[model samples]
Target: MVQENNNKGNQISRRSFLTTGATAAAGFMIVPRHVLGGKGYTAPSDRLRVAGIGVGGKGESDIAEFAKGPADIVVLCDVHDSRAANSVKRFPKAKYYKDYREMLDKEHKNIDAVSVSTPDHNHAVQAMAAMQLGKHVYVQKPLTHDIYEARKLTEAAKKYKVVTQMGNQGASGDGVRQLMEWYNAGLIGDVHTVYCWTNRPVWPQGIPWPTEKAEVPKDLDWNLWLGTAPQKDYVNKLVPFNWRGWWDYGTGALGDMGCHIVEPPFRVLGLGYPTSAEASVGSVYVDEFKQGYFPDSCPPSSHVIMNFQGKSGDIKLHWMDGGIQPARPEELGPNERMGDGGNGAIFIGTKGKMMCGTYGMYPSLLPSSRNKEVNVAKTIARVPEGHYVQWVNACIAGYGKKELSAPFEIAGPLTETILMGNLAIRSYDVRKPKASGNGFDYPGRYIKLLWDGPNMKITNFEDANQFVKRNYRDGFTLGA
Candidate 1:
């Protein structure tokens, strides 16, 4: 049976309802019928009433995956109606809204969960708002644009006692589990260094913003699309995908693919916050003699090294993007592909090395012959239904009832670790007028940034802290 709100006609505000729920012994006024009926009895209201925040592109796919499970996509929201057309068509019964805030505010009581697949900048605010209303949330990867936002969302998940998951589906895959088993069996013993690389930024980067402004599409709510980002005129072609190149809306390649590529090592090694970070960015030459550094844009490429003090020992992880790759390992054949040709990860351990592609797929230990020789008992349960279904099942199972593969508790730290590379990339461009007045002095260059993981600050460089937590534009805030 569908869970009925005990306070039917009272129409209590979402905040009041949540507060009452917290103080109540049951912890929730609307208990699922299954809980009352005991095990083996499926409730008619067991179907999760899901609301999607950005139903376009990846958002469309995310919603579709949820819909495949015992979920009803009741509300579909997107800043650009044109971008959301596909999802709207798929779920004709779903109520449509251009603004997520309005959708969440009006539908908070009706919806069971929210799936946030919006731009990086808007992720934290939307997810936090839903969590505040006591709704479970599944946010897309690179969980938030900034480290502080990632940290806040992580804390909010626990505070609200909501089932949370980040969109890095690889966390739910069997490949990561296979790798974990291999590592646990002492096949790849004590990984000391790791390399993750991606050939991204296929979108334009290392360039200035377009000078020409374009008229906003009639179907697109430009301001709503901007969300917490500073108000700016809509630029042509920035909406669909190219925004990944900019610092304001997207997090460049690191944020784009880091979650997928870095997740394996994090999961396998039980990694945590890094102690220090440093980076070198590739520059785009504007002229024969001069190179340009666009502060508003991410560099064309970058190589970041982060040092994590693990329980076993210190780990040095290298991140390379924009076609940069590490040297070929001697164990693999000369013709063997390194990192699935474009994006992949390599783990160097005391015993051997293993590599995998994005989403932890195609895991293979060094020396292909070892694959047949190694056989270890599977210790980790596999999410065969996949990442989205795992989250949906967990949400239905209620908070603290079932284990999630990429719960915010795990994804948040992974996101923070991924974004720390971006901090180094942005800091690498910090410059001031030189004392001689001939050229600018890049003070951020050639310095290792010491980090206080618990505090979320760069102890060595004060200026770098600005990127740790961005200032939300007027009206939007990461409310406590």
Candidate 2:
């Protein structure tokens, strides 16, 4: 299924300018707007070429989205051979490779865009490489593993002048659009607080420590799976999907779901950065917590709180999961059901309220009065039709914000918000003594997220703030 055709897009200077040698985040000395497409990068249309990394699970669906109309899936990439094969089967017209970096270099000018659906740890690395090549990027959500990376990805996309979209499809969906529209329209007067959660325990939660290394599957690439993370023997329990719960690969539950859960609030409120953040958990434990590594000071089942000093008011947005919810009202919709693993959110305003669960605020609005579900906002066309399509279309028709929603500017913060949960987990452990001992511990811990955009620090508490920017093993500093 390998393609042999040449690509068509011109090698326009990626965004405003950066010589392709700039390494750190803000190392270049120039006014950003002037140097980095002071306005925005011009996009290419007519004929678009695309590739996909991490071509398993959700990656499969992403392939189809990119292949719609005038777009060709040229290269398939993944850490595992099996995953890559699956992607190739879906797009029998594309070639396959295990290392995305190799594919980018070999394919060079052939790939115009790349879909990055790798593990949370690899998103930035893979996506950043694609951007450096002047290829547009579409990365899956929880866009970054940490706060700094979120900003780094944004800066890279602008530097490369590529069209980009975080995998948070809901950002442009019908329900979320209403969640914010209602707030903006004053339907939910003076929003004060928001609570959201996802019921995700299948990925090794509620289980004891993994003392034994899982027999690495031959089909799996153990080394690739652990990219950038400290080396360790492969464990089936943490491979593929379960990694999300672990401190190493996935971003824990919050990292897994927060970008979607907390997004409505971030957008509706026009939130800047968290003022402070604190997390509490129930019996947190890790095989081993390393400094500079994830789980630095957090438990596995950590509940993180990100507090933002809103322009109009102060609010505390709570996160929870694992057989828990924000307290369901006695009633639910007729077949308008909420999965037993209740994942959703509820907003508390000065008057009445509004709530949406699991798939980004769908069910019952609050007050029951105005809570009636109508296509209050624009309809969200499901996957092959909705989010993914929107991103591709927008990129093709330059200046398509409404089309390619969740661009870097918006996605950067969304990813930063979710990473708080991951970092918070890094700040707790089941056997270790309490961290930031302000009486905050697993089962009943609270760290408020304080946003300090100027400093790029969380300013919640010195102990917690230090965690926001973890020590990268070495040579992996946030490419500045």
Cα RMSD to the true fold for all candidates: 5.1, 9.4
Candidate 1 lDDT trough over 10 residues, lowest sum: 1-10
lDDT of 1 at 36: 60
**Each model's C-alpha lDDT?**
0.86, 0.65
Name model 1 segments beyond 4 Å from true. Answer: 1-42, 428-431, 434-442
TM-score of each: 0.91, 0.78
Total backbone collisions for each predicted model: 1, 37
lDDT score, candidate 1, position 7 = 19
Tens-digit per-residue lDDT, 1-480, candidate 2: 111212222232223223554432336443343454545533232346788888888888887766765567888888787766767777787887877767987986677778988888778888887777667789998887777888888877666566788887777666766676677666667767778777765566544435687688787777767776777777655656777665556676777777777777787678776766676565544345512222322233556677878877988888886655666544444454443246777787876577775546474565454555534554334343566777666555443233466889888877776776655544533444556332333321344445576567655444555545545444343443
- Pairs of residues at least 3 apart in sequence or in different chains that clash in candidate 1: 1-44
Quote the lDDT for 402 in model 2. Answer: 39
